[model samples]
Target chain A: MEVNHISKSFGSKHVLSDINLTFEDNKIYGLLGRNGAGKSTLLSIMTNRNFADNGEVKIDSEDVSDNDSKLGLMYLMSEVNLYADGWKLTQIMKDSESLYGGFDHQLADHLIQEFGLDVNQKFGKLSTGYNSIFKLILALCLPVRFVLLDEPVLGLDANHRELFYSELIQSYSDNPRTFIISTHLIEEVANIISDVIVLDQGRVILNQPVEDVLAKTHSVVGPQKDVEQYTKGLNVIGHDMMGTIRANYVYGDLDDRILPDTVQLSNFDLQKLFIFLTNQYEGSGKNENK
Target chain B: MEVNHISKSFGSKHVLSDINLTFEDNKIYGLLGRNGAGKSTLLSIMTNRNFADNGEVKIDSEDVSDNDSKLGLMYLMSEVNLYADGWKLTQIMKDSESLYGGFDHQLADHLIQEFGLDVNQKFGKLSTGYNSIFKLILALCLPVRFVLLDEPVLGLDANHRELFYSELIQSYSDNPRTFIISTHLIEEVANIISDVIVLDQGRVILNQPVEDVLAKTHSVVGPQKDVEQYTKGLNVIGHDMMGTIRANYVYGDLDDRILPDTVQLSNFDLQKLFIFLTNQYEGSGKNENK
Candidate 1:
């Protein structure tokens, strides 16, 4: 699937600006962005739930707008609950099965038992965590080629979140497909996602494989002057200083310059990288509208 | 502050049962629990926002219920917005200052600048993340001795969450107080909290200093048979197996047992400990009310 020059605006605010992205087959992608970075809007446009002001979303070179067949190939489990409040979980699943087709009843039943969800209970009666669990169950059981999960583990506890990750991996292994997950819990999904797509102020800032992103990023720590000297010409996204010690977060390759005795280079995690990258962009004040 | 034999129920549902806990001054506590664990209910009861079916909450040997002076020392920043929808952030802060007294305007203004929050925006107009930031600013600037935060970073992004944690630590350092944070994001708060309290099925399952709990938990890994033999007669909370390899999570002291050549012991993190401990209690089928 491809998002080509997708731009959207609400009134005077530009939510997405000429956004372009490509999602390959049989891969897990982490869609990362700040609170108002237009992730949900982009997802909505891609799924035809919302229309974009410019460009189009295409699957296999065919535009997905108002295209039922292409739309059926993708499923988006977002935080919003669209089902009727009075509907029971089982009834909702049945409705989804008929509408989407190819629902895995066996997997759904297993998940219901595993999560201890009572299918007879009304949708509105479930707690926040259970509501998230129910949506996750549906997303996993559907036989869609692309599964987009937005805040999939919104209110899940540690045990349930672990279970969901394991189940997702198991399902993916059994039937490989594209899974694009957008969540605030970066550390938890860092290792789970194969590739990452980061959006900053409605623009695609970083899109690369997890391994490549981590390989290029480094944390240079030591005396403030020495660390700054080592990262002088590099892509230092941000830095932190505590008294005389400093740590420069670099997002690009390091030079062959001999390392100073006082400076040490170490790999940083995805969460830290995200924080620094986003923070640096915020400091630039490129998009003051948001 | 102490919670003595507190119990609460709503109609046919029992929310909290015989809960007992002590919050020491100048310390941070992580209150962890699964969905429907009655964590919110317990916090409400402790803060005198809700009534308990039995027992009482006391501070310095004085009943906190109906005692305005004692209750004034505590503040509960919950998910629900208590301010009027049309009220602006500045007005809300002013109201809090009048009601709570000793509101630190300097810290509040600094936080507003740091978080990039627009104080002129109405409470209802703020985005989810901004709303959380507003509540967090209030919680931090308040002069309460016991501040209870329920899902403080609910909608915050990676950068904002990191900032909140750092700001929280800084605020605590500047003004020594008790902060009992109840959140599902366990790993994030694991290091920030000095003590952890786990509630399961409306019952207090585990409560201990973070260091002490982590000191006793071990992850025994090896061949399935070897791992089982090594962990025999020990408090093995949970275990995972893949083919021939097995890992058993134990939560108690080792009895100086002979070590098998194929087995190795290592430390487990707070999240792992919480998962294993909660899962063990669930398997026992105690209470089963929730």
Candidate 2:
């Protein structure tokens, strides 16, 4: 799937601007951004739920606009509940099968049992966590090449969230397909995602493999003076101070210099990187381009 | 605050069974449980939102039931929104001040600006994340001895959640109060919470200081044969196998003994410990009485 020069605006505010990205098949992509950072907007335009003011979306080199065949290949489980409130969980599953075709009944049944969800229950009566599970079940069972999930684990408990991740990995291994997961729980999804696309103020600020992005950033903690002197010229994104100790998160490559006995250096995870990057953009107007 | 032998049942379903716990002043407690494990029920009973079939809750040896003075000292920021839909943020804060007697308007104003929330906006108009932030601001600002936060970070993003944790630490340092935070995001609250209460199937399975609980369990990984030999007769809570490699998570004390060269050991986090304990109960009917 490809999004070409996608730009969107609501009144005078630009939600997304010239966002060009491509998602290759059979790889998991993490669509990450701060709140109101155009993640949902870009996804909506890609899935054709909302129209973009400029550019277009393509699937298999064909325009997705007004194209049922192309749209059929993609499935987006958004935060908003689109299903009718009157429908039961079982009925919703049947409806999805009828619309998408080849709904994996076996997987659906397995997930329903695993999550301990009552199929007879009404959609409106389900709790917040259960509501998320219901949508996730539908998304997983549907036979779609490209699946885009927005806040998939929004209300899921830790156990359920863990189960969902394992189940997702299981299903992906069984059937390789493109998945674009947009979520606020960065650490939970950090390991599962193959590539990351970070949006900031309607612009693509960072896009790279998870490992590569993590490799460039490091957290060096030690005596305040020594740490500051060591990271003086590095692209320091953020830092924390406690008593006389200091921890500086430095982005970009670090020089192969001898470290002090008291200092300790470790790699920065996705969550820390996202915080520092977005925090930098908000703080000092430092935006990195890909 | 203390809950003595609290038990509740609706029809034949026992929602809470003999839950006796105490919340000391000036400490944070992480109330953790799986779905349907009775976390919400316990919180409701503690806050007097729902009545327990037996036993009572007390503040300083005085029964909280029907005692306005005692109840006023505690507050529950629940998942269910208590504020009216038409009320603005400022109005809600004012209402809270009038009711609670000492709402910190300065702190509330600071939080509102920090989260980029508009006090003029109606409560219903706020987004999911903002709604959580709105409630969190009130929880932090209100001058109460005990605060019960149920899923406080429900719809929060990474940056906002991080901000909330830091602010919580800051406020707790300035004004020490008892905070019982019930949520499924264990890793996020692990470091912040002083103690943990793990409820499972209407029972309090574990309750202890964070450091003590973490010290009791460990995960040892190595070859299947070597790992099994080393962990023989040990309290193995959970184990996973991949080819010839095995990772066994053992609870209770690990003896100081020499291990195989390939075997490695590490601590089990709050989330992993909760999952294993809960899984153990459901799988083997072994409930440790600690």
Candidate 3:
């Protein structure tokens, strides 16, 4: 799947600006961004739910606009509940199965039982967590090659989130496919995703494998002077200060020979790196949220 | 503040069952539970937003029900937005200041700038994350002695959530008040909250200081036979088997002198303990979500 120079705007406010991305099969991708950072807008444009003002989204070199075959290949579970409020859980499942075709009824039944979701319950009556669970079940049971989940575990509790993640892993292992998860909960999905795509102010700021990203960035902490001296020539992305102590996030390898006993080096988690980078972008005040 | 044998029900479903707990000032408490586990119900009842079927809620030996003076000391920031849609962010703050009588406008302004919240925007126009931020700013700036935050970080991104937690610690340290946070994201709040309160099926299953709770529980992992033998006489809370290996969670101190070299002991995180305990209670089916 490819998003080719996509650009979108709400009146004069640009939501996505010249965004370009490529998603490969059988890989889990983490689409991370702050609130109103164009993560959802990009996903919606790719799925054809919303149109982009410029450029296009294509699958297998074929435009997805008004293309039934291309549309059938991907499924996007968004935050909005498209199912009717009066519909029963079973009814929704049945309708989705018929529309999507090849829906895994067995897996759906198993998940329903595992989550203790009653098929007889109406959609509107479900709690916030249960509502999210129902939508996730639909997304997982579908036999689409590309599955895009937006805040899949939005209202799930700790145990339920754990169960969902384990279930996702099991599903991926059994049948490999492309999974793009966009969420605010970073640490929970950090280890599971293979690739990281970070968007900041409608532009793709970072797109790399998780390992490669983590390998290049590290936090070096020590006395302020020592830390600054050590990271002077490195690509220092960000830094934190606490009195005489300092921690600098360097986006390059360190020379072992120059290492001192007073300093310590550790890799930055995806969440920390994300926070540091976006903080810089947000502070610039050029790309404000409309 | 104390809840004296509080009980609540929704028609035939018992939402809260004999919940009796106490809250002291100058402490941070984590009110954790599964979805539909009665955490919100307890908070609502304590804040006088919802009436209990039985018993009374008292603050300093004074009944809080319909008592304006006592209720004035407490504030509940719930998931549901209670402010008028037409009101602007600045308007709500001013209204809250008049009602609370000692609102810290300086801190409110500082946080608004830190979060980059637009005070001119109407309440209904804010995003999910911004809505939470607005309410959180109010909760922090208020001079109320007891602050009850229900899902305070519901829609916040990673950076925003981190910022909120740090700001909360700063406010708590400066003012020294009681903060009871009800949330499903356990790991995020584990380090900040001093006490843990686990609600299961409308019951207070566990309520203890974090240090005491963690000290009593540990995970022992090793060969299946070795783990089983080691935990035979101990209070085994939970266990997991993986082929020839096993992991057992014991809720009592171990005699390190008698432990075999193959056996490894590790501490259980608050999330893991909460999951294990709640899983057991939920599987019993006696406290089902209605």
TM-scores (chain A) of the candidates = 0.95, 0.94, 0.94
Fnat, model by model in order, equals 0.82, 0.65, 0.82
- Each prediction's total of clashing residue pairs, residues at least 3 apart in sequence or on different chains, is 0, 0, 0
lDDT per residue, candidate 3, A1-290, as tens digits?
98999999998889999998999989999999998899988888888898989999899999998898899888898887888898998888888888888789888988888888888999999988899999999899998999999999988999889889988988899899999999989999999999999999899999999999999888999998888888888878777767678888887677764867899999988998888778744344222221
Clashing pairs in 2: none
Model 3 bad stretches (over 4 Å): A255-257, A281-290, B255-257, B280-290
What is candidate 3's CA lDDT for residue B35? 80
Q: Model 1 compared with the native: what TM-score?
A: 0.95
Docking class of 2: acceptable
Model 2 regions more than 4 Å off = A255-263, A280-290, B255-262, B280-290
| DockQ-sorted candidate list, best first | 3, 1, 2
Q: Of the pair 1 and 2, which is ahead by TM-score?
A: 1
State which candidate, 1 or 3, has the greater lDDT. 1
Candidate 3 has which clashing residue pairs, if any? none
Cα distance off (Å), candidate 3, residue B94: 1.8
Which residue pairs does candidate 1 place in steric collision?
A: none
Off by over 4 Å in 1: A280-290, B280-290
